[model samples]
Target: MKILVVGGGTAGTIVANNLARRLTAETRSGKVQLTMLSASDRHMYQPGLLYVAFGQMTPDQLYRDQASLLEPTIDFHVDPVKKFMLDKKQVMTEAGKIHNYDILVIATGSRIVPDETPGLTEGAEFFYTEESAVKLYKRLREFQGGRVAVAIGVPHKCPVAPVELMFSLHDYFKARGIRDKVNLKYYYPIGRIHTIEAVAKWAKPEFDSLGIEYETLFNIKEVDAKNKIVKSEEGIDVEYDLLIVVPQHRGMEVIERDNLGEGGWIPTDRHSLAMKGHDNVYVVGDTTNLPVSKTGSAAHFQAEVLAENIASIIKIGAPVRDYDGKIYCFIEAGRDRATYSMFDYETPPDLKPPSKPMHWFKLSYNQMYWTSVRGLL
Candidate 1:
């Protein structure tokens, strides 16, 4: 039997390593095999992109080679998956590598589609991907004091990132001695600034303290890039000297192209992480249409449940585990302070105090993630 996992990010890497360990005996006896696919050997620590964009960290600091994180038993293909042949139970890659699997895990994550919004690419700078983060870093480096507008073009991955960027931008301007000259504003598409009530409750005062105005119920209809203005569908317009944004996030192109998505997200059983029509296929991370924060912690929690179920199905007959959509998000308040929140499926995150100690924890965790992925942390 063979298991094919179609991602190599936080969720895919963690699940593959866990499954490899659980199926070691089978692998050793030639009874089972595990493999993964991605466009490259590199796995970007996505959250770190925020720091990289601010020049607080180097571009190379945000990535790790997947080979270092996965077990030696796993065969990793640094190739892009072109299409999924559901009837054939095979995945075709652009490089002509055909893969067949008895059990499939579609952890392809999310893709940021800026083209989904008109004039957004022309006016706004987004930092979700490594390439975009690097570009933003260059832009931020040369930017002088001006009105900066940050908004979400659509539902984005890493729900905490835009807020983090706002806080970090506050720090960035202050540190550059232009805090008095620069004006920063954030417009959210949803009614609330965050999905988690506790997070939104605590963030309000903090954002106000930094002089960053937060607006809700702002739906972006278009960006007049040439005029340096963002127009909302509700007849509101924001003028800016520079614009930063989180672009619309969608399921992998292959998934959408194959009609495997529900409104740009792959629908799955939140509890079991399984696709409805395919008993042997599971979805995780930003790909799932779960009403939870699409952070790495959420991915980690999903991976644990999915990997256990995969192991059980291989040994017994069916999955017995479930995911509760748990997540822990550490919000960077500024250069020296941070706050965190934790919650699961039916509960709202309880607010936690912002502290410098928590900032160190977040910084320390970034360096320790490699060890954690290897099951050491």
Candidate 2:
């Protein structure tokens, strides 16, 4: 059995590593072979991007060589995917390499396209990438203080990140002793500040206490970046000294070009994460069109569930496990304190106020993730 996993991101790495453990016997007997295809050699710790912007972490610490994360027995290829020939069960690489697989796992995730919104790419600073976070850090330091508007253009990966960004920004400015000088505000298209009603309810009082104003249903129609103003379709206008935005996120262009997604997102079973009509192909992470937050925790749980299902499928042609849509998010609430939320599809998030103990746990997770998740999980 040939298992080809595209992407070396959080979901891909978890599934690949766990599969290697579960199929050790088959792999040693040459009955199962594992391969991972990555566009870049680096596996970016995306959750650390916020810390980088807040000057809490350095860029170098957030990335690891993808090749080092895998066992030597697994085939690790640093090649960009050109397209997918699903009908032929072939993965076409940019270097003209074609790899055939009996089972393919598509964990390519999603990408943020600044070009999706006019003036957004050029106008506001985002914290999704290393360069963007670094630039935002510099810009945050240089700004004396004024009206700061954080906006969202479209649905993004890590849906909770924008909310967390607002909290961190508040903390950032407060630490500088210029919190009053900065009139911080947040705007998102959703009807509520957060998708989870319980989370929003928990944040409402917190936002009220922090004097942070927020506007919902504010859809961005144009970003007048040069004028430092954001205009929404409803004629709502906001001016800002600094614009922090979470721009549009879509599935990889390759998935779109190959017509494998619905509006650049893969349609998969919410429980199994298997691509519809493609029994042997599976997907997880941001690329899947699930009405859930694209957080690392979601991917972590999905990876475990998918790995088990794959093992069962290869043995008896039926996936026995199901994903519960579980997610855990640790949100920083300024200073060195954080709050946590845990939930699944059937349950609402149980949220609490920020505390120092949770903060320490959040800090510890970074090291734990880099070392080994088996114990932590």
In order, what lDDT does every prediction score? 0.85, 0.86
TM-score of each: 0.96, 0.97
- Residues 66-174 of candidate 1 have per-residue lDDT tens digits of 7888899998889878988878889999998899999899888888888888899898898887888889998888888888899886677878887788989988888
The sequence of per-residue lDDT tens digits that candidate 2 reaches over residues 7-97 is 8888888888878887878888899999989899988889899999999999999988887777665788999689899999998998999
Error of 1 at 106 (Å): 0.6
Among the numbered candidates, top lDDT falls to 2
Model 2, which residues run further than 4 Å from truth?
A: 372-376
lDDT of 2: 0.86
Candidate 1, pairs of clashing residues: none
Clashes of each: 0, 0
